[model samples]
Target: MNAIPPAVQPPVNDEIDLAALFHSLWEQKLLIALVTLLVGLLAAAYAFLATPEYQVQSMLRPAAIKDLDALNRTGVYELTPEQAMQRVGASLESYDSRLAYFRANPGLFEALRQPNRSLEQTFESFNREAFKMLQPDPKKIDSLSAYVGIQLTYPADVNGVTLVNGLVEHAIQAEREKIAADLQTVIQNRLNQLELKMAAARANYEASKDARIAELLEADSLKRAQLQDELKALRQQLKDRRDNRITQLDEAIRIAKALGIGKPTTPSALGEGERVAQGSVIRTEVNNQQIPLYFMGSEALEAERNALLQRRSDDFTEPRIAEIAKELQLLAHNRQVEVLNQRENEDLFLKDLAIWREEATRLRNLSVDVTELKLVSVDQVAVDPLRPVKPKKALILALGVVLGGMLGLFIALLRNGLRRGASRHHSDQSSLSS
Candidate 1:
């Protein structure tokens, strides 16, 4: 009997019963249909009631060469088309610039106001996500040109078109103003430098002029002193010679008076001629040797001495004295130094005066106007969109139906399993009671 009990085998149920599962699902088909209908209604309500969003886009490209020519011609600054475009792009991306624009134009963003949020918070959120800058992918080889685009996604009620276009214009204007201001600053700095240079030149010229005046005055003083000393010496020498001549004449006059000679007489006049041969008359010796003072006659010497004593100035007696007087007169006042000292505007005499004045004048008069200058070429302006991009009704409704059907099928299978388990439990109780 124990050997026979060992031969009993356990049940094997690896395969699923497809038929029973299908029958149970079919029995709960009404419940599945009701759940699917309820879910479908909710999905339809959401698809129809949701607010629609619109996308407005604008395309931008680099400015043309001619558009930036005016700014580049200043010589103080240079900007290319690409650089201008980059500046415009940077302005567009600046949050401060956007806020300024938004504050300046209030009516444009009136529709974006929310009751639960302040204006600043709303604007911050809008600035963060409402605007998008689209550029070509760097990894893509098909990109032919460097193009930028601005896209705005907003509610249908908002003026997306006006907002995008106005933003672009504001960015361009901001960039233009920046360029003009930078150029003006450069020109002003150059003018300041030139002014400083001119001032230095004037100061240097005045200093040099003053130094020249001092030098000329010192030279004139020294020359005048030297001339006065030379004149005094010459006059003294002339006086001494006159006195010596007078002394010699007195001595000669004493000798002549003692001999009783009253007129200029040679040796022959004293009877020497009678002793010489009749045909050989002695001639008066004439050479560089001065004749004796007594031979000049006392009357002639007395006359010359009286004339020398009566003369008021000895300058006329010597040629060198006259020359010295004339030189002293010339050194009395330096005409060049006087002219330099009396000058009111010394800058005019600077060697580089003309060059500095010309350059400074040009800089002061330099003007740059960029009011009409175009910094960017708007390839496409935003237009009112004809359709919305959000609220995909068809796709949402399809997903809702599919999900509802799956949930309903799962509920029906669980209910059928519970009913079968209840029936098995009742049968087991009845068997135990019997």
Candidate 2:
């Protein structure tokens, strides 16, 4: 056999074919080097140019009026604390309802960026693009948000900082309006409920008032009748007393008649007994004018006679009827006053009912407003502005060094690839020398 070439042995499992790998790599090495350098330089440039972002944080507490004391007890109110808390929470939840109102107004954001945006609109194009450029995604805004969150967020750009700040401010405004409206609505609802209760109460009072008035009217009639009856009895008693006084006067008149004071005293000149008659007549006249009238052995008869004559008066017009008339006048006046007072009270009750009705109406309006205000609730506060965080200059510098070394290695790899044929010849020489 011709001097056979020594058997060419395949490499073992533990060994790698470096020559084959190096050959394959050598083919693409130039393009790979260029791409690697480009990537490294691009990374460095990104570090230098990346904009930085600053954050503004805020926390808010939900506020609302609550019946805290009563709500704390379950057995007393037949409701759980959770339920009562929920009610209070509902009142506060309305703050989120007015978010849209703030979103439309950009001026609010401008103010927020005040120190930053002195005079620049900060963009080459429309405000929308500028805002986007200055701000980050909204979803990432909040760092710590649950009950309260960031209401607005903004990005920093040499040109568009104002726009981003404006957006954030609008967001906050929207939230605030929403909160106020919500509370107002809840209050309104409560007011309406109170009004309804008050209205019902007023209606009942009015009904009761009517019944009371009727009762009073009947009582007034009874009182008037009683007064009239009393007057009648007094008048009768007065008449009887007057009748007794008149009867005594009649008796005195009879006594005076018997005495014959007004008859002529001269005797007739016809007979012997005529002088005796004249004498008798003179005696009668004496008795009537100045006789000592004794009455039934009573020692005070003379005093009584004097008193009877002295007590008579010409002004004694029917005393019974006069007294009755005076009493009736007083009763009629009292009845009139009671009637006036009752009417005034009824009027006042009606006025109170009207006021309650008005209050109820206002309450209703407020409840509706509360619904609209719910959008601004604390949970809805903006957590993030639309801006990117600032780049770390130190980190970028470190990365630049690393990438530069990798780039130099890639350049060396390409050079090795291009000289692969020369190296292979040199390898043969090494074999001969060996």
Q: How many pairs collide in each candidate, listed in order?
A: 0, 42
Model 1, residue 126: C-alpha shift (Å): 2.0
Top-TM-score structure, candidate number: 1
Candidate 2 global TM-score: 0.34
Angstrom error at residue 162, model 1? 1.2
Residue 302's lDDT within candidate 1 is: 65
Provide the TM-score for each candidate, comma-separated.
0.74, 0.34
lDDT of each: 0.82, 0.47
Spell out the clash pairs found in candidate 1. none
User: What value does the lDDT take at residue 80 in candidate 2?
Assistant: 32
Q: State candidate 1's TM-score.
A: 0.74
lDDT by residue (1-434, candidate 2, tens digit) is 68957655443353446886567666756666676667667777887777565444433333332323322221112323333233333432333322232345445444334554442332212232322211134578664422333222334533233333344344445444544555455566667677677767768877876687677667767877876787667656656665675566456445545643232222222113334343434332223344333222122433454554565532245565566567667655556446645675453655466666666665444322322322223323334445454565667666765776577556666666566657766866776565
